[model samples]
Target: MNRRHFLMGLAATMATARLSFASTGLIAPINIPLWKGPPPGGGGPEGRVIQSHSGALRNITVPGLSILLPSSPIGHGVLIAAGGGYKQIQDGKEALPAARWLIARGYTAYILHYRLPGEGWHDGNQVALQDAQRALRIIRQREKQVSVLGFSAGGHLLGMAATRPDYRAYTPQDAIDELPASADRTALIYPIITLEKPYTHTSTHRILVGPHATASEEAAWSVQHYVSSQTPPCFIVQAKDDPRSDPHNSLIMYDACQKHGVPVEMHRYPTGGHGFGMGKTGTETVEWPGEYKKWLQQSNAGG
Candidate 1:
């Protein structure tokens, strides 16, 4: 390894070394549904396990947040959305690990088990957004500053929330919906940013919009196009070799953020592939969680 590359790797390693995998003797997570009665959907036998072993959920009739409060909070909250390509919510591999990572760093974390769009929900494309918006609103009720992190398709959903602050997925069910759905800062880890041709995640795109989805429909869902000056600061991570979501997605998002003058930073690792979750052990991809910590501090996003 050359001097610069070695230094970069060493720096990333040192930065992430403080945050370990040890679950901080976690407090019982509060699993509260987004709605009291029924959600704005038509699906039953909810909470079906699609990946039987992964504990990824499907057809979520009762979408909700699994709240994890750190023993010592930094007075900010992170709402996490783990991607499952619109078919299942990958709680096992993504959300839970991420929540533990955040809470260990003294941040309250909420893992959103949002509904899948194709699971019989009316106006299905809007199902995930509604649940995500609701989860953000609920967190905002207790915390002053709340940020967000989305992985894979969850990144697409949270991307919508970050860009579309005024979109109403469903009629306001209560005052909880009054809170702003906007994020203080947004973090996307190997996210699926676009529904456009040749760039979209195949499973996510096929499930949310059919094979015959129109250009306008595709445009409407692309987060890069929605980035405005009003969009919050963004931090992005993607490995060039990512085979699933495509590293180009982050490039598109970074380009839009830059064009719009939104505060943005992107770290494109040469390797590490996709869905490394908290990152693959002993690899530079594991550096992101550390880099993210430094970003929260530098951006003062931990407020």
Candidate 2:
């Protein structure tokens, strides 16, 4: 299949994810527009909230957060960026499951519904990063503590946001942008870490940076190159057997962190190929969620 066809094939599966999220034991979440006025690029109305279609998510007209608050307070929040190769958000399978997991664990979770880079946004590659920064700022408004967790392409976006939080992807429109976009903690799962050769997921590379992106552009977009000591503590997990995203991705990020003196840890499973949200049942990857929670708790305890 071609790139679009392959991406669509992956997106088609999103419709069948069967998310009965009502059982997640969380109360209904409040939805907030990421931008108060027109979003910096001027795609549509300022703060326009688009009702997402029931089947498959695409053509994001409005970027917002579905804020899930836990009954038991952990005094911290997490912003989740779900991966869809920058073609879709995968809200049902990847993003929501992650939000539910966080909510159950006493985290106030913000599920980011960000713009797709290919959808005609001006400076499209930076569009998702803008939304992520805005969402993080909003969460910061509520409290000083917030973390970020990203899966697949979302990881790529967060990688840029976490490292180049001051890149100024777009003109800041409000005081909220004054808040730093940095995450207290970062987690990347089965992510697309590089926009360059050998190990890059071609479709994602194209969708985010374009098929003909220059070598310098690709290098600039690559997350590993931007790591610094100031970057947040990071946790990475991916199955070495993953067919879509390569195992090199996790290693690349870990190496970057190590080189920069940023605390980081990685878990490579023997099985469980890819897109195993909350872990595929009957697979060893199922242990990742628990491990992540333990890490988060320990990070909290250490501080």
Candidate 3:
């Protein structure tokens, strides 16, 4: 059978063989605050509140991380950042499913509830990146290898972390800052990769760089410009028909990776639109998780 059919068959088999979280034999996740006390430069909207928008959490004041260990350990970890157009956190649609998928594959997964850029936070532009860096450092202490996975605006954050791991969003205030924040590999799904006009996600850019952003600031946040030989290997997924985020976002990043000789792979499906997650029952996008699994295996073998 062809690859698509094979993956569909596998999905059917897995569906029938799937086990519940209680029966999976995995340990429950431990939710940990990113900071020991109030986060640095913390002049955001007072008090942490859970406001919902379109059934997702928004207006986050306190950022944190949660660690879920796999039943069968592989000594690898993934930090997952859910996309919300930089306005909310899509934990239900993006983060949790991704974590469960990774855990079943024997890799520990950390789900990050990063601060939103427009949420009245001090230096809001940097808060999400700071939380991401802090989480990476913490995960590094336990896992020998750690990768980053992000969707939409979260993907933008992952790209920034991968390219500019040395850039500190906040001054060192503790021992965790001493650890490296770099990711070994990255996976971006329908990411917002650039701040440039036309291809850029306009609302995301406004929230991140502001409406009157300077040319220099725009260039600084445009992640593709920071790509170098040191940037981590990446696996990108997108759909040609995604109206929310242009497929060029993934294309430009892929081009830059190739230019810098950073190992990269990109899969673009014809349909599935934007934010389809692991794809529908019988679509081509369903093959992405399987492909990523193979890629990780190859990476482990030094391929």
- Each model's lDDT: 0.79, 0.78, 0.79
Candidate ordering by lDDT (highest first): 1, 3, 2
Per-residue lDDT of model 3, residues 130-186, tens digit only = 899998998899888989999988899888998888888899879989999999999
Worst 10 residues of 2 by lDDT: 11-20
Q: Tell me the spans in candidate 2 whose CA falls farther than 4 Å from its real position.
A: 1-26, 44-55
Query: Would you list the clashing residue pairs of candidate 3?
Result: none
Cα lDDT tens digits for candidate 2, 1-303: 233432343333222221323444455567666765445665422222222453236756656787888878688889999887888787777877888788788888888878887776666677888899888888888855888999898898888888887778778787888988778999999988888787555567888768778888888889999889899999999998988888898999999999999989898899998888789988899999988998899766865
lDDT (Cα) of model 1: 0.79
Candidate no. 2 TM-score? 0.88
lDDT of 1 by residue, 98-205 (tens): 988888888889888777777666657888888898888899997867899999999999998999988888888888888888899999999999989876547888
Off by over 4 Å in 3: 1-28, 46-55
TM-scores, all candidates, are 0.88, 0.88, 0.88
| Cα displacement (Å) at residue 52, model 3 | 4.0
Supply the TM-score for candidate 3. 0.88
